[model samples]
Target chain A: MDLLSNLSLGFATAASPENLLFCLIGVILGTLIGVLPGIGATATIAMLLPITFQLEPVSSLIMLAGIYYGAQYGGSTTAILINMPGESSSAVTAIDGYQMARRGKAGTALAVAALGSFFAGTVATLLVALFAPPLTAIALKFGAAEYFSLMLLGLVSAIALAHGSILKALAMVVLGLILGLVGTDIYTGAPRFTFGITEYADGLSFVALAVGIFGIAEILRNLEGDQDRTVLGTSLGGLLPSRADLKRMVAPMLRGTAVGSILGILPGGGAVLAAFASYTIEKRLSDHPEEFGQGAIAGVAGPESANNAGAQTSFIPLLTLGIPANPVMALMVGAMIIQGIVPGPNVASEQPELFWGIIASMWIGNLMLVVLNLPLIGLWVKLLKVPYHVLFPVIMAFCSIGVYSVNSNVFDLYAVAFFGLMGYVLLKLRCEPAPLLLGFVLGPMLEENLRRAMILGRGDPTIFVARPISLTLLLLTLAVLVVMFLPSIRKKREEVFVEAD
Target chain B: MKNITVDWTDAMAGLIFILFGLLFGVQSLGLEIGTAFRMGPGYFPLVLSGILLVLGGLIVFSAIHDRGGEGVGKMAWRGLFFILPAPIFFGLTVRGLGFVPAIFLTTLVAALASFKMRPLWALVLAGAVTVFATLVFSYGLGLPFRRFGPWLEF
Candidate 1:
C-alpha cells in the first residue's frame, strides 16, 4: 500500500528469473542499437513491438523500457568515441564528450557518464514510485472534458517544443491526426478513410506506420550521405577519474538529476530538454564557464545524468494519465494497447504487478547497463564499425518480418513501404515526424473526449471553460501557444536547438 | 540585374500539405457530417482538413517572404532503385518462392545498392542472411511459413 511495500512487490515480480533474463536481453539489444549509427531507440522499439505480443505484458514492458534508457547509455559511448551521437539526447554529450576523448580522457568521460547515469536512474526510479500514485489520484478525477483539455495541452506543448518552424510542427500534428482517422468510425460505424479496403476497416497498422517512417525512411536518408566515420581515440587511456574530476562531477550530476526529474514530468519535456537545460544550468552556475565547449567534466556529467533521469521520468505522464508526452512514450502506449492492457490511472490499481514491475525493472536495467557496458566497451566499439551499407539490408529485413508477423498479412508490409516513402518526403521537407506519431496515437482519444464533452454540455462548447481543471488545462494550452508565437521566445527556441546542431 | 532566388523546400512542403488537405476535404464531403452535439464520422476529419488547409496556407505565405534555407538535396535515386524494389520483390515472390529464396534474392538486390558490395560478396552476404533469417524466424520463432515453396517441389 505504501511506497516501500509497493516497491518490494515490484522487486518480487521483477526479480523472477524470466523477467531478469528478458530485461538483460532487452538492455543488451538496446545497447547494440544505441552504439550503432543511423537507427535509434524509437525505430528499434517499433521493430520489437511485435515480439512483445508473445511475452507477458509486464516482461514486454520491462524489455521495452530497458531499450529506452539502455540506448541513452550506449548513445554516450558513440558520442565520446566517434563524435556521432547515437541518440539525440546524447547530442550535447558529443560536444564536450568528443573533446574529452581528443584530450585523451575518453575512458574518464565514459566512466563518469555511466556512473552518473546509474545514479540518476536510481533516483528517478524512486521518484516514479513516490510520485506516480498521487498523480494517478489526480488523474482519476478527470472527466472527459478535462481529459480532452489535457490532450489539447499535450498536443500544443509537443508542437511548441518541436525543433523547427512552429507552423510546420503544428501542421504535422494535424497531419498525424488526419492519418489516425483511417479506420472505421468509432461512433457511426461508417468508414472514414479506409478507401473501401478491408485492411482500412481496422485502421493503419501502427507498426507499419512507425517502421516505415522511422526505420525505412532513415535508411533512405542515410544512403544519401557517405557511410563512414573516424574514431578519434585508439587507446582508452586510464579508465579511473582523478579526485578532482569526481569532486567537480558530483554537484553537476545531482543538479542534473534534480532538473531532469522535474522537467521530465512536464508534457513534451524529455531527455533532450533535460540534457540541454542541465548543460546551460551547469554553464551559468560554473565558476569557469569557458571550459564548457572545450572539455568540461561537468558538461559531460550533467547532461548525461539529466538525459538518463529525464528518460526515466518521462514514463510518468504515460503511466498515470495514458497520455504520451513524446514519441517513445506513444510507442509504449501502443505496446500496452497491443497487450490488451489499457494504460490509464486505473492501471496502477488494477494491474499493480505490471505498473510496479516495470518501475523496478528500470533500476535493474540501469544497473545492468553499468555492469554490462563497463566490461563490454570493446565489443560496442567494434559494433560501431559495422558499416551502414551492409547493416541496412538486415534492418529492412527485420522490419519486414517483424511487421508481417504482427498481422500475418502482406497489406501491412505494403503500408510500411508507402509510409516509408511518405516519411522520406516529409523528412526532405524538413518536417519532424515525431509529433505526427504522437498526434496519431492521441487522435481517437481526443475525438471521443471532445464529442463526449460537447454532448454533456448540450452543444455549448463552454463546458471546457466551465470546469475548473479543464479550464486550467485549456488555458495552459493557450498560454503555450501564445508564448511559442512570441517573437522573443520563438527566437530563443531556435537558438537552443541550433546550438546542438 | 541582381539575381534573386527563393527557397522551394518549404514551398513544396506547403504545397503538398495543401493538396493532401484538399483531397481529404473532398472525400469527407461525401460522408454525413453531424452537428456539434452528436457528431458523425466526417465531423472531426472535416474540421481537421480545414485546419490543415489554413496551416498549409500559412506555411506558403511565410516561405514567400523567407530569404534563405537550403534547397532540396539530391534525391537518392540509386538508393531508391535497390532499396524500394527489394521489399516489393520479396513481397511478390515470398508466397511462391518461399522464405529462403525470397529473402535471399531480396538481400542480394538490397546489397547491390551499396557501391561497396561486390557480386561475390553480395552472394555470400545474401546466403548468410537468408540462412540466419530462416533459422531465427521460421525455426526458432516458429513463424508459420514454408521454407521452400511449391515451386521448389520439395
Candidate 2:
C-alpha cells in the first residue's frame, strides 16, 4: 500500500499538463541529438541547463532525465541505419543492427530494439522504485570519513574503467582536482589558484568546462577527417515484427534486462559495460553463434534492452548517495546545484515530489519514445541527410550563447576556448575525457570530506581504517586498483577497449 | 649508436601533466600548509601535485619503453585555427556589436573551419542562424540581451 501510494503520488506529479509538455520537448530534443552524430546528450544537456533555469526544479529535472534515456532509444536508430552510434552505449547495437539493415530487416531490428528497450525500461523503473528507499536509508548514516572513502573508491574505479594508460587517467584526475581548487578555500577564505583574476574567485565555471571539453572538443575531432555517414536507402520493410521474431527476442530481452539492471549500479560507465556485456553474452548463449556478427535477432534485442535498463538504474546512485556514476550524472549534480537543490540522501526526504517526479517522468518519457519514434523514423532518416559542414557552426554559436548566459561572464567564454584546445590535445594523447569530468565534479567535495574527516579523527591517518564502512570502501578501492594493474586483466581490458574503438 | 625512439603523443601528454604538477605544486607552497590535523588551502593540493608528478614520470618512462607504437596522428590545425577562436571572438564582440552581429560573426568564423564550406554559403548559413537565434533566444525566451549595443550607434 505504501509503495502504491508513492507510485500514485509520482504519477500525479508527472502527469500534469505543464510537466508533460516539458518532458515531450526534452524527449524530442534528445532524439534530435541522438540522430545527429556530431553532438552528444552531455553537450545538449549542458547547453540547455541555462534555459532550464526558468522552469520549476522538478520540471527541469524531468526534462533533463527524459533527454538522457531518450538518447539511448535514438542512438540505436543510427546504429541500425547508419552503422554509427550517436551515443557510445549503442556501439554494440551497431554490430548486428547495421547488418540487419543491409538484409532488409531494418524494420525488424528497429522494432526489436524499441520493444526490448521498453520492456527493460519498465522493469528498471520498478527496481528503482523498490530499491531507492532502502539505499537512501543506508546513506543517511554515512559520516564524513565514510563519504571520503566512498568518493575515493569512485575516483579509483573511474580510472580503472577508463580507456588508455591508467597512469594518464590518474594524472588527469589529479589535474582535475587541482583545477577544482582554483577558488577561495572554504575553511580559510584564502584564494588558491586565481592567478590574480577575480573572475575565477568562485572557481572555474562547470558549464563552461563541460561545454568546452564535450561540445567544442567533439567538433574539432570530427573536423579532423570529415567523412560521410551512410543511411539505408530502402524504405522500412515493416514496422511490426512477425510472431516468430518476437518469440526469439523474449529470453534475450529478459536476460539483458537482468544483467543491465545489476551492472548499472556500479560506478564508472556501467551502461556502456552493460550493453557490451549483453552482446558478448548473447553471442555465447546463441544456438547459432556464427550468426552474431552477420545479423542475429538476439544481437540487436539484447544490447538495446540491457543498455536502456542500465541507463535507468544508473540514476540510483545519484538519487541515493549524490555520487555520479558517469559524466552525464555529474552534470545532473551540477543541474541540481543550479536549481538550488543540493543532491544527497536528504533530497529524497526533503523533496519527495522532486525525487518521485523524476522517477515517474522516466516511465512517461520511455512510453513517449516508444509511441513517437517508430512513426518518426522516416523523419529521422530525412534528417540524417543534412550535411555536417553547416551543423558545427550552429553548434559553436549555441555553445557560446549557453556558456555566456550562465553568469554573463566574458571570461568563461575565454575558458571555453582554452579548455577546447586542452581537450583536443588530450584526445590526441588518447586520454578519456569522461574520467576527468568526473574527477572535476567530485574534486571539491572529495577534498572537503577528506579534510573534515581528518579533523574529526584528530589528524590520524588511521581514521579511514578505524571505521568499518570507511575501511570496507578503502579495501574495495584497493582491490579495483590491484585488479586493473594485474597483467592478465590489463591485457583483457586493452582488448575490450580495442574492440570498442 | 643505440636506437632511440619515442611515442611523441605519450611524451607530450606526460610533459603536460608534469608542467601542470610543477605549476600547482610551486603555487601551493606560496599558501599556508597546515599540519595533517588541519589542512590549509595548500596541503591537499600539494599532495595531489606530488601524485601527479609521480604519475607523469611513470607515463614518460612507459612512453620511452613503448616500441613500434603509432605516432601522433595528423593535427587539426585548420580546425583549431578557426574553431578555437570563434568563442573568443564572440566574447570580445558580443558586448560591442550585440547579439545579432556577435552570433553571426561567430557562426561565420566556425563555418570557415571546414574545407567543404564555400564563402557565400557560409555567409547565408551564418545569417540564417543569427535570425533563428535572435527570434528564439531573444523574442521567444526573452533573455535580456541588447539587439544592438551602444557601439553600433551612428
Candidate 3:
C-alpha cells in the first residue's frame, strides 16, 4: 500500500522535464553502444559515470539505470541482426535470433524482441516495487557475520559461473581481492598498498578498472581477428508482429519473466543467467524442439524478455542490501555513492523521491526505448554495414579518451591500455573477465565484513555459522560446491560453463 | 586431454600465489602493528597470502597427479605479441604528449598490433582516429586540449 503512494511521488518526480530528458538521452546512448559489438552496458555506464557528477541524484540514477536496461534491449537487436552478440546476456538471443534473420524473418524477430522486452521490463519493475521492501526487511536482520557469509557465497557463485579452468578463475578472484585492498584501510589510518602515490591512496578507481577490463579489453579482443566484420543483409518487412505471433509469444514471455525475476535476485547471476535459463526452459518446453536453433520466434522472445527483465530487477540487490549482483550493479552502486546516496535498507525511507523516482523512470525509459528503437532499427542495420577498417579505430580512440577523461590523467590511459592487454591475454587463455570484475567489486566489501565479523566474535570462526542467515548462506555455498564437484553434476557444470559464451 | 590445460594453468597459478605469499610474509616482518584484533592492517593480507600459498600448493599437487589429459605447450606467441605490447606503448607515450596524444598513439599502436591493415592504411586509420577523437572529446565537449603550435590557437 505504501508502495503505491511512493510510486505516485516517484511519478511526480520522474515526470519533471529534466529527468525525462536525461532518461531519454540515456536510453538512446545506451542503445547505440549496446548495438555496437564489444562495448557493453557496464563499460558504457562506467565511462558515462563521471559526466553525472553534476546532476541531481535521482536524475543521475534514472539515467544510469536507463543505460542498463536500454543496453539489454539494444543487445538483442545486434544479436538478431548479426550473429555477433553485443553483450554476454544477448548470446542466447543470437543463437536463435540470427537464424531467424537469415531466414528472412528479421523484422518479425526484432518486433517480438522489442515487445517482449517491454513486457518483461514492466513486470520486473512491478516485482521490484512489491518485493524490495520485504527483502530489505529480511536483509536488515542480517548481522555482520551474515553479510560476510552472503558475500562468501556470492564469491563462490562467481567462481562457479566462470568459464575455463577453475584455478584460473580463483586466481583472478584472488588478484581482484588484492587489488581491492589497495586503498586506505577503513578502520586503520594506515595505507595498505598506496605505494606513496596520492591517487592510489583512494584505492583503484572503479571506472578505471571497469573501462579497462571490459571496454578496452573487448576492443583488443575484437581487433585480434584479421577480419572483424559483422554480417549484414538488405531486407525490410513489417515491424509489428501479427496476432498469431503474439499468441505464440505470450507463454514464453511470461515464463521468461518469472525465470528472470527469480534469477535476477540471486547475487552473481543476473541478466546473463536469466537469458540462458530462459532459453533452456523454452527449448525444453518447445513443441518443436528442432526449430530452436533454426530461428524459432519463441527462442528470441523468451530470452530477450528474460534478459531485459533481469537487467531491471538486478537493481534490487544493490538498492535494498547494498550488494551488487553484477559489475553493472556495482557501477550503479558507485553512481549512487557519487550522488551521495548510501544504498541500503533505509534508502527508500530516507530518500523516497530518489528511490521511487528511479523506479518510475525505468518504465518511462522502457517506453522511450520501444518508441525510439523501432525507427532506429533501420539506422542500426545500416551502421552494421560500416566496414571494420573505419569502425574499430574510432572505437579504440573513444575508449582511450573515455578512460583518460575520468581524472584528466594520462596514467589512466596507460592503465586502460595495460588492462586491455591483460584482457586480451585472458581471452586467449579462455579466462572469463566477468567473474574477475565481480570479485574486484565485491572483494573489499567482503573483506571488510569478514574482518568486522571476526572482530565482533573475538576471532571465533564459529560466528559465521552461529548466525541463522549466515549459516544458511554458508550451507548454500557448501551445497553448491559439493554439487558442482559431483561426477554427474561436474559434467553438466562444464557444459554450462562453456555454454555461457 | 580433458585435464591437461587445467593442470598446467593450476600449477602456474599456484606457483605465482606461493611467490606472492612468501613476499608478503617477508614484508610483514617489519610491521609493528599489534595483532590484538583478528584483522590488524597486516592481518587480512597475511591470512590471504597464507591461504593463497596453501591453495597454490594444492593446485600444483593436483596438476602433478592429473592423468586425464595430455600436456600442451607453454603459450601462444601470436597472442602474446598482439596483446602484451599495447600497454608498454601507452606507458611510453602518455607523459610527454598528454592524454590526447597518448590516446592517439595508443590507438595507432593497437591498430598496428591488430595486423589487419597495411602500413599506408594504418597511417590513414590513425589520422582518421585523431580527427574523430578531436571532434568528440575536444570540440564537442570543449575539453581542454594542448595543440602542437601557437598558430592553431583560437
Off by over 4 Å in 1: B1-5
lDDT per residue for candidate 2 within A118-216, as digits (tens), equals 999999999989999999999999999999999888888878667889989989888888887889999999998899999999999888888888877
Cα deviation at A16, candidate 3, in Å, is: 2.5
DockQ, all candidates in order: 0.68, 0.87, 0.34
Model 1 docking grade: medium
Over the stretch A84-122, how does candidate 3's per-residue lDDT look in tens digits?
777778889899888888877888899899988999989
The collision pairs in model 3 are B1-B69
Task: Give one digit per residue, the lDDT tens place, for model 2 in B1-154.
Answer: 5567788788889999999999999999999999999999999999999999998988888888536569668788889999999999999998999999999999999999999999999999999999999998889978888889878989
Interface Cα RMSD of candidate 1: 1.3
Off by over 4 Å in 3: A47-54, A228-230, B1-38, B60-111, B117-154
Pairs clashing within candidate 1: none
Clash numbers, per candidate: 0, 0, 1
Chain A (alone) TM-scores for all candidate structures: 0.98, 0.98, 0.95
Off by over 4 Å in 2: B1-4
Q: What CA RMSD would candidate 2 show?
A: 1.4
TM-score of each: 0.97, 0.98, 0.89
TM-score of 2: 0.98
